[model samples]
Target: MRTIAYFLVITLICCLAPSADLSAQLNEPAPIRLRNASFEDIPRNSRAPVGWYNCGFPAETPPDVHPDPMNQFQVGMGPQHGRTYLGMVVRDNDTWESVGQELSEPLVAGQCYDFWINLARSKVYLSQSRVSNKPANYVTPAKLRIHAGYDFCDRQELIGESDMVRNYNWQEYAIKLSPTEDYTHLVFEVFYETPTLIPYNGNLLLDNASTLIPSPCEEVVAVNSPLVNDDQKEPISTDPVPGPVVVTQPTTKSGDPQPDPEPQVQLGQSKQVLAVDAVFEVPDITFVANESELTPESSASLQEIVDFLTIYDNVIIEIGGHASQKATADFANRVSMRRAGSVVEYLRTRGIDPRRMFPKGYGKSKPVCYDESADCKRRNQRVDVKVLKIE
Candidate 1:
């Protein structure tokens, strides 16, 4: 069994490794750092928050989500036939440039590392063209090259490309790289071609572009049982999926087992963490005297939830209902499951997309209050709302 498990782990790693010998190089430690190379600020747009950057161009404009650019990049809005309802454009003669810091002073050779870019839009191309291809209108090409070693046109290497058919709203773009030899510096280049002699002003929006020495899979696996390994599972655990109001015990504050002094701040000088606009709390529609169910008072709470969703046409939410210790394990599990299903059914009637909402029920496994008292048990028998992802 042990041998089988070991083989499983190794097979997992081997199967998971991408081409280009990148996985080998990720195992080595790279001094991680960030270099903020941002362009001038343009008016904010609701769609894409992170601005654009330059790769090799002398002058490039920053990214602006707004419909129009005040100066420089002639920003315009367009619609992708099958993609998003709207998209951004770079006016003639405007280019954007940004820089990223190496994870280490000099990238180490022969260690595995992974690189990814957090993307706000997907199916877009990061293209490379010949020095003579200087027409702005020839923007998108049928194919784009992918690699980490393409700063100057001379060292362009295609690592791997992303699926460009589907629309991934502001997601992460990652790639692994392994060096055949060491080079102190590398350049990044992005462009696209679409079989036309259009102007060639390059345009794209990106953020959190990074290169890092990946931690060993074993350490990460130990810490997070279901780390995003060969299976490509979701990073967050969904077993009991956490709920809205997660109450964690405060950490020890003093060396002598004594409390630290409370923090103080002047009025109006402090900032309050903002809450997500989407409301995802479990509706108070049901609970038992010693169970998880509806007691008639839940209707109002449930209605409030429905109303909230109706008001925000674009909002999406997740509901996680929990049970108390009063019930047996089997009973609690069934009750929690029922509550979750009921909530989903109720919301469906309210015209919310079933695809947008995720309902999970965790019986006594996740309790707000650990005590066995009646009051504590009641408090534990609660529902929670969380905004999983906002559009």
Candidate 2:
């Protein structure tokens, strides 16, 4: 009789376990999501992308949706991803362009997030200068400023700022954000090199943004991590996203750690010919959470594949997107399939022949690692290239 009662108790606990899990899930905070994150829209001058609101300086022109196709400003760089990218300029008159959006969820206070965005420069951003009426090429490099605010265009606190983005090639920048207060809006804006008395014409190109993935406070480089410092003082304000806010607080007293230096990856390297069945693992592929879009940093490795294909013209290949073990086989398959399709689309934009490439998804059946830790799971989420045929 005691054995039967023990079995009944075990069954009761098992029945309630699912309900407890569901309740915990319901109590979790909703992730903050950005709308139209890739900035896809009709390319136009002085227009913000579809979902982002224009928050440029008062009376100044708004940020631009680039690759205008008409090429009025002499800027015609193709986007790293999607149809159009963003073009923001810091004018000689000290004004700049920016754009903003309300978050899907408010950023909680004292939360640390790992944010990533792709930034580049246009060498031929021709526009009439505010200082001189003649057309000036906005070729100088500029920095990026990200901000969180209570309302549209309100600069409540500066979250992330970047060094001068000098590379013309697209590269992903990981910006660490530490917010002290809960906020609902985020802004991205362009600013000039710091410690300069005079502002000059400069341009910044933006594409392929990542969602703010919650991260351990001690990972990578620490920028504005509240865990490191005890005081609640504001670091020097470079500028906020959407617009530049005049700094009202004191700048850091020299000893505080500066932002991590910009990452540099040389593009356009030659590659050896790939034979059939040769599997090449791309080391830099990172995607937005739950989305298949490749981050800008993936360009470095993706370019190698392009170079390989361009040289070995007869090689046919398969692109496979793999995911970690999921709840069901069908769910894993669908996720991997979408990721593979996104890579194919990116290659197509770069002039790769669609006929020579096949997209496949491996799902959880093939994980690079089975440890099941978060880092290991991230490693398991990957894209692989297999030479299918050598025509």
Candidate 3:
């Protein structure tokens, strides 16, 4: 009888333990569904897909519902999920295209969620460039940005974004969206590979968007549906750490009244669809030897950081610096710290919030390679931006 009582108590404890975890889990509302999410629209040019409204700037052209049967601008890609898909562009003139819809339920702040969408690029999105006023291929790859706003195209909070859509065929992007506040509206916009630095010509194709589903804060990325990039990250921001494309104007041979251009405004954002431990190498970011001053040639590369920070407003990052073993530990530590702080300062000049970033120097403590060769030393001397928190 005593043995039976012990087994009963053990079973009760085991069952009760999981229930205790429920307290940490949020009481998320039901899974939200979108109306006509697959973008079932009749083929048309300069118009948004059915059920999704145009969210671009005033007088700016709306996204197109393709494959126009007419094959306007040479965008004839077939839909992977339905009869039609959405096409949008970013132009050198500083304007882009987007669409938005009301959410079935408002996303609660501090709750975690994710959604899936199919994205690709068109090889021959033929259009004229505003800078050249001549026929230019809008082929430079672009990306999809997901924003949460209260009204049409408000873009109040950026919730998710995909890596550059380089592939021509349709590929699914699983984006984790962690909103900083409650939002009743959502917007889908196409942006350049880097959001404001170059505002060049590029296009993005989108279709078959899935509804936002509540997910565990620590839920792992979908194994069967991998992220478009090799890295696995969740959308969280850490405060006090620091960080951080193509646009094409859509117009055909036929003369149409060009839309009023929006003033040049660049948005620096955080990585919302990322895991907290994610580390990214900012390409072409280099500094003078033993000095914290960034090399002049690194301007374009550094601009990429500005664009990323503009969109991810709800997260914080760590600008971690490293040094080779050639220098003594003390020297290396100071060098790395100054370099990391220099990167943070550069972003501050570009108008990023200083509170979102802090610097740390690993010095020679963490080397990618130990050899004394220049190649190995250069490899070890690098900078990494680590996401520390998502607010």
Candidate 4:
């Protein structure tokens, strides 16, 4: 009887142990599903993916899905999780490509979650091909930024940005998000670290983007999917230290003609001007192709110039307008002149004295890039500001 009782007690303990384990597994949070997460459903040549929208201008080049056999840009590591992935370009025209999508569900405020994506840099991204003379210019390397916002195409809150991914191999990047506000949209952007730096042409490849998953367990699941190599392990940092967060003020929607509030300028103060050798070019002041009309997006950058002139009353500047090789030399020269004159007129309206400003058009005489690529042409067609005199 004593032996039988001992056997029964052991069996009961074993049964209870399995039941407890089953209950714990049931409590674990399920993984969130991201639509078109692997970028596999889209057509090969489509500019925009099926579940994503172009965050940039319609005229600008949109982000494309890769495995570009036609352009022969398939030499690098393939998609980290599927047959296709996203490709974006930051062109010398100061225009960068971005794509965004509405999340399956809004991120709950104050909830800690894990997010990740696979990133790569294509060594040979063909921007344009010329049948005669100069050949194509490959895109360079640039940083990739991911953002979260409440509205469509908004980048009000930066989530994470990878260090310039120059390697041709695919790398997994991860970040933790603890949102202060509910966010429904996510954006992928290409930008220079500093706005004052000269714009360059570059390409960023994206894939295996996962949605924010609630993480109660300390262990994070590897981000690799079936398409990735079975032997390859997702890079994970244990007890990683969080970095500083950067948040940007929301920008005015494009095409809104209403100007932003101008800075207060005090008159009669001793004039302070930049050094005579200082030459600063406005990075965001751009125009439509072949047209001198300033884009509405140029308002913020132009405002900065206005504030600078107000402080330096004794300074004089020369605005030089240039054009790409998109048109005949004579036509390019005429349009370039008009472009420079437009800037002068804008400054004049903002209370800058006409005597302190000189506007000149160089046409296509000086080219930033001699190659006949699209990015090269955009770089060549620009307006530069030089400080001529600082009395």
Candidate 5:
């Protein structure tokens, strides 16, 4: 009778196990917990904050927990929330740091979620060099990118990003996600301006990450054809089978073909690029005394030229370089050539076709202001982009 009782007890325990497991599963949270969301739970003597792990390679160092009291890493400012935040660096060796965590629950498909995080960058950052084995060089600010993914470690979907965050104060950034598939992970990374070509040491601070909340789906409006008549009635079909509706492409009238529409280009301001003809002076492209390299100011002006040429693909321009009277004619000509070449190279880097651009050096032959005053000299040392051809 005792042996029989033991067998019955074993059977009862087995029967209750599955139900208990199901109950626990049902009680699990639907939304992600966003563990260590504020990054307040850091442990002493550790590079990474609690509940977060390095998403980079095994050799790569994890992100540092900061308000670094020992002055090992310079954050320039305090954390945005709590007493600490996470900091990641992109070193000169092309290796960047990233941190990530698995969400408490996976994101559901077809759901819109509102997510936000606080981001900041130090004006400067210092680190130890792997090559020199001494204190590494300090670098300027870079951008930060946040990614989301379904897998724990593979965060391939970019959710939010910032242009070079050079500010010392913390700034809040938000991104809305309309996920197609269930995503369960988030990653924060530091990157240079041009990630593939340039590798520089820069620091990015992350803190006060907000939990994802369900957002309302965007409403879409249906556009009806202007040609459709509201009072028109459909004729009763005599045949049982219906024919497929055919869409006709728009065509020009035979004798009077309409010209293609003028391309619209939005520089800092909006403008229309017509096929006829136009001329605009690039007055801001001023160079430092005889230097062929573009300064930060010159780069901004050149970027405007790039934007203009990009939209008007059929347009061709001559990049004319000039110099001040301080240099000899031969020296000035060479300097001018170099300056023109520099502008062409910059435009090429910006994805403009080289064939459409012509670079010429004027050698101070053509000056907007011919006087010998400082203002005139500055005006003479300029690059002019003249529209040569437009289709």
Candidate 6:
């Protein structure tokens, strides 16, 4: 009898013990999805993606007819007060309905998810929504009703829409969803108007687009599903320590745009879909022996570094120096320190935050190429960059 009681107790404990799975929330933190977006940073003078239909006035429409000018980054589409008709007009190839990118992976039924995007538009155009024949056009046919519902192709219910549009600059647009039944055909669309009429073209700049799944466990299960077997998630890095934060600043005050400073974690480091490895490399250059002086020849390389930091102001780096075996260890150590300090001082003079840069001397201990040859020693007796951390 005691043995039977003990067995029962053991079974109960096993059942009651916590599982390694996530909680069962309709909007849990699992199963979220994301993708690289192009709309965020509209290229100054580039063509739109393929299959994006342009169905407005013919090329004779004054400023609207011309391709974007070189170095011109602003959208020509005027405000919604009325159509001025002078900008790029593109619609998706699938529906040609002004929707953003299509979901790379289909959605599952009975589950909720969030679709997010960055949008910035002029006051002249109001972004609207709708549903239509699969390959619909922006030219609406009176009877169409655009509501929040499950798109069969994407398998999600369009639960919410954005009211904040126009003149305010780039902001996020999120569509919440919960499909009633599992289906794999449909698309959620946003346009300049509900019943788009007339040639009202306004500029819309977008970026940082993604989809969110409330539950992590659900995401794991979904990934393993036969439907998604062939659809692989972007590879994640194994190392926990990300490489470093990289910031780029302009070398000259001539008004050129700054480079991207987004902190991308090295591959496989992030547990979240939004976390990315900050990929950054210092431009290779030669320095004077035991000194922190910039040669006129090194100007091009140094300028590149400045350009990166100008755009991405949020980054931290370890500007380290090393020495060759020709010098005594202590002397090499001093040279390394001076070399590192020289680089830091130069960046400061060029307007970089001293706090964002760290200088360290490795002496002769850390050699890039450990050969006794003069050339090899020269190669190793140099300064290299290491990205330490990013927030």
Q: Which segments of model 3 are wrong by more than 4 Å?
A: 1-26, 220-391
lDDT of each: 0.43, 0.74, 0.74, 0.66, 0.66, 0.43
* Candidate 6: Cα lDDT at 264: 35
Locate the minimum summed-lDDT window of 10 residues in model 3: 238-247
- Each candidate structure's count of clashing pairs: 48, 0, 41, 0, 0, 43
Instruction: Please tell me which predicted candidate would have the highest TM-score against the true structure.
Output: 3
User: In order, what is each prediction's RMSD in angstroms?
Assistant: 19.6, 19.1, 21.4, 23.2, 26.4, 16.8
Report the poorest 10 consecutive residues by lDDT, candidate 4. Answer: 241-250
lDDT of 2 by residue, 124-193 (tens): 9988899888888998888899999988877788888876777666666668788889999988889988
Which stretches in model 1 have alpha-carbon errors above 4 Å?
A: 1-27, 37-54, 57-104, 120-168, 193-203, 215-391
- What's the true lDDT of residue 114 in model 4? 73
Query: For candidate 3, lDDT tens digit of each residue in 334-385?
Result: 9999999999999898767899999999999988788779888877888877
Estimate the lDDT of model 2.
Answer: 0.74
Per residue, candidate 5 scores C-alpha lDDT tens digits across 53-157 of 778657877777777656666554677776668887877777788878887778776766666667666665677776566886455566677687966567767
Reference-based lDDT, residue 229, model 3: 45
lDDT at 199, model 3: 80
Per-residue lDDT, model 5, residue 279, is: 39
Taking all chains together, the TM-score of candidate 5 against the true structure is: 0.45
| Model 5 spans with C-alpha error above 4 angstroms | 1-31, 42-46, 129-134, 216-391
User: What range of 10 consecutive residues in model 6 has the weakest lDDT sum?
Assistant: 220-229
Question: How accurate locally is residue 214 in candidate 4, as Cα lDDT from 0 to 100?
Answer: 68
Writing each residue's lDDT as its tens digit, candidate 4 over 291-339 gives 8899998787676666567535567989888888777899889988999
- lDDT, candidate 3, residue 359? 96
